[model samples]
Target: MTVTGHVKTAPETTAQVLSAEQRHADELAFLAAYDDGARPPGWALTPRAVVTFIRGSDGEPLTLPAERRTGTLPATMTVAAKFVGERSLVERCVVTLAGERGLLLVGEPGTAKSMLSELLAAAVCGTSALTVQGTAGTTEDAFRYGWNYALLLAQGPTPQALVDSPVLTAMRSGRVVRIEEVTRCLPEVQDALVSLLSDRRMNVPELAGTEEGLIRAVPGFTVIATANLRDRGVSEMSSALKRRFNFETIHPIADADTETDLVRRQATAAVERAGAAYTVDDAVLDALVTVFRDLRSGRSDEGWDVERPGTVMSTAEAVQVAVSLGLSAAYLADGDALDLMPGHLLGVVHKDDQNDRARLLGYWDGPVRRRAEDGSAMWRRLWDLRESLR
Candidate 1:
């Protein structure tokens, strides 16, 4: 099915990554056509369809009307599942957005919290470009609004002089606004969201008595913020700010097969984007993901105790290691990338803390030695490569 207006028409560039809206425009269009369920105010799709778009269909084909199947809109289109996690979580998130409530996703780093937020915003509002990246230095201007210095100096605090941040714009347009790493911001800076969320309005004293100063959020305005639980104690959210959001915790991929599949898919995409052929073997990816899971959980699959590293052994790190292994193979013309896994893992483990080396070595001495003795050739090879870690 050819979707006309919504699909991006720009020429494909190697390095550019399209937003969620542009990437799945056809699937969204298909769902919009097939289901005519009622949508909340300012939403592009119904709540149910939004969940379907994120969780994917059960291979059931969605048939469109014969007349509407013109250019890119085919007669039948199957929606591919975007998220690899729980369907109930996606439903809860969709319901929260439909109710115009703030949603906060907290998890260990690399659990795809940011990706989920982007997809949810795109599905509900038809755009995910409105975003605020919270950091230690993030000021109130980021959450509220800023003034155009030149316009403000010449005309004073007029409508044209007011510069809208993503939050303010989302309020006026009733769209989803994303705040990434909310816990990274200072507590005072984070508190700026309390009044805007509770009152559903942004008051600008600079332009008081003007129509532009008192900007009330329309019916569909909502916030989707993500925070890394690793930063739990640092710049923690105030009780008031926490009360405004419906919290959801995104756990790391539990099953090894699911994690390996996600790593393969994401790594292949990364490799292709780098203009390199994907040559990483499945066995190598499986081993890589297994080792990561073991290190992250501080236990071998067989229940041996392993010391966890200070660094986060997240799926994102696994994807990076896979991509690096693929790139090494592509450039060096190496036959198999399995041999490079140990070195990549060593690099990942020793990232921020020098003491993590000892913890990693503890893992190599315990789990790696045990797995080697268990008759797995890959584990045996990894065990032999333990000297490389020193």
Candidate 2:
């Protein structure tokens, strides 16, 4: 069996975003070889090793064999931490997956729940492509199976006529399947997983009495679903459905410095991908993150009260704002990147709700104005750009 799933080489210039498994294939290999601990059945790495892959190593050098040292994997490789949240939460998530219980990540929009799900699926099953994007239109077929109309018409309920959903494929292959925005699906549609999880089998009525009629989940097959808390009322999940999975609440980044670092790193990668030079200054980044954190929390670092907008002020949005600043600095080349931040923030704040603009103005009047009065040059410049919000 190949350690990495279907390794394929791509030209450097054309290589776009890779899945977590493909992008971190070497790292996974190194950890798999280094870790002598026993892993759950069908798992690519031990639970501890999986945590290390997600939370990162403690800068200690890994003792690698000669064969493992290739490309970026040197003799002493340190796994860079990917997720920026609490290590204990990740440990719990890994432990839940190790137990083969479905893991459901719930959080506000942009808290990286979906990203965490993808990382876990990749680390556990060596594949993260098996996924179902849950939406209002998501039906029972999305969670179980569907049929190829033409083939079904011609062959009449034969195996060839069956089209496997991601969940079914994961069941057959013993891989991890991701369901994004599970709450977005209608309640009745979302309950389709209740029996699938409890019974660990899916029955195809059309193929009854045949070998393929009943599909049983293989070892290591599990679901990792994510739900945005902001969409709670859109479609509530049933109690029976919620009981099948272990729920984990992913919180937003609490530390401004850490959030700023993440935004800068992601934005830099995005800018590089766009073939542009990243020129956003560190001071500008710090200022931008500070403003976002203050407004998001409805209070400044000094504990001053401010009104938050209805829109989610997330780290992911910060990355986009940073990327916009970088692009402006790269192409516009006319003003400081900090000068463009207020405009970008305004655009993000004024998304669907017009009342959010009033809330933004309140934030500016409360925090931005006070920060500028405190003689911070960055805040002073940001205060000057306040008129742009209007």
Candidate 3:
């Protein structure tokens, strides 16, 4: 079905922010409250409901009437498809919320760590905006408190000058505070979390005389931090800090069909963003998915020898390729644009590095040629002229 084009607005939040239907589902989640984890101090749905909010409901569907939630209530959310590798890993993350422990998600880049953390924050807290990106320069003040210099000088140790970091706010409010790229921070810099986790409070030494000292963690207070395994040469975390967190390693997607579906879904959203209609034919879509699947895992569908590409064959990259092909046909060529079978994929496979080109050729010789011989015209042409690029 061709959707009429609508120019995308510059979203104040994410494009995938839930809609009205999801809003109903969210309230129903709290109403049903089928063990949505432990409730943070001010939170409605328990941590379990928060998990159900992010990861979709396997429970019976809700039939509640839709009503516009006017106040600044937590936006209803669902975990996206990118993190489909495991269920136990996600469960651990959700359980970490029930405790005061920090949930550290370590994985290779493009493993959907950041998005998962963001979704978790959104579901547990009312907003995913409470975040501190951990970089080499991330100061201890970022993890704790920062006094407003001007306000502090003017008002002394008053509450006005007592600027609260997300961590401090979460301690007081009992919401999930997210620290992205935990390994990117220096070893000592990451250690700022040690006291926060142990005491579940931040001592405001400067404001010692009044109501501003010792911000204690509320019931639902916890941290969700993401670290890339690929960022090894940079700042590595210390053992003590790692001990404070419940580590959940997010692995890459195992199934080719799952990845293909993710690529198609993400690509559609991207194309719709640019006001372009996505009409990718299933044959071409399957071919593109096949090429990606083969190159990514270093094995063919028939378990034949297929060389691995040096570059990462991430689902993020797959969406890019699919979006690219959709754009090329929608703007430059004729008829349905979806009819393009295998010609467009050749260039996408051969980019990033020349070694990728060699692997792609090997894939063509093995799988594409085999499929062609098995009687697919588009693949047959692709197999025969595979070396045209090099």
Give TM-scores for every candidate, taking all chains together and pairing residue i with residue i. Answer: 0.94, 0.94, 0.79
Q: Write the per-residue lDDT of candidate 1 for residues 165-255, one digit (tens) a residue.
A: 9999999999999999999999999999999889999999988887876889999999999999874445888999999999999999888
Tell me the RMSD of model 2 versus the true structure: 5.6
* lDDT per model vs. reference: 0.88, 0.88, 0.70
Q: What is the C-alpha RMSD of each candidate to the true structure, in Å?
A: 5.0, 5.6, 5.2
Candidate 2's clash total is 0
Residue range 1-390, candidate 3, lDDT tens digits: 233343233334455545322434445444333443446565655756655555555544533324533343333433233346565666678777766678988877777888788766766666667889988788888898888899888877787888889888888887888899978877887888998887787788887867767677878788999988754446877888888998888877788777778778878877766667677776667777777777777887788878876666666766777887787766665543333434445566665667776766677778888989999886776676675645
Could you tell me the TM-score of candidate 3?
Answer: 0.79
Measured by C-alpha RMSD in angstroms, how accurate is candidate 1? 5.0
* Candidate 3: RMSD to truth: 5.2
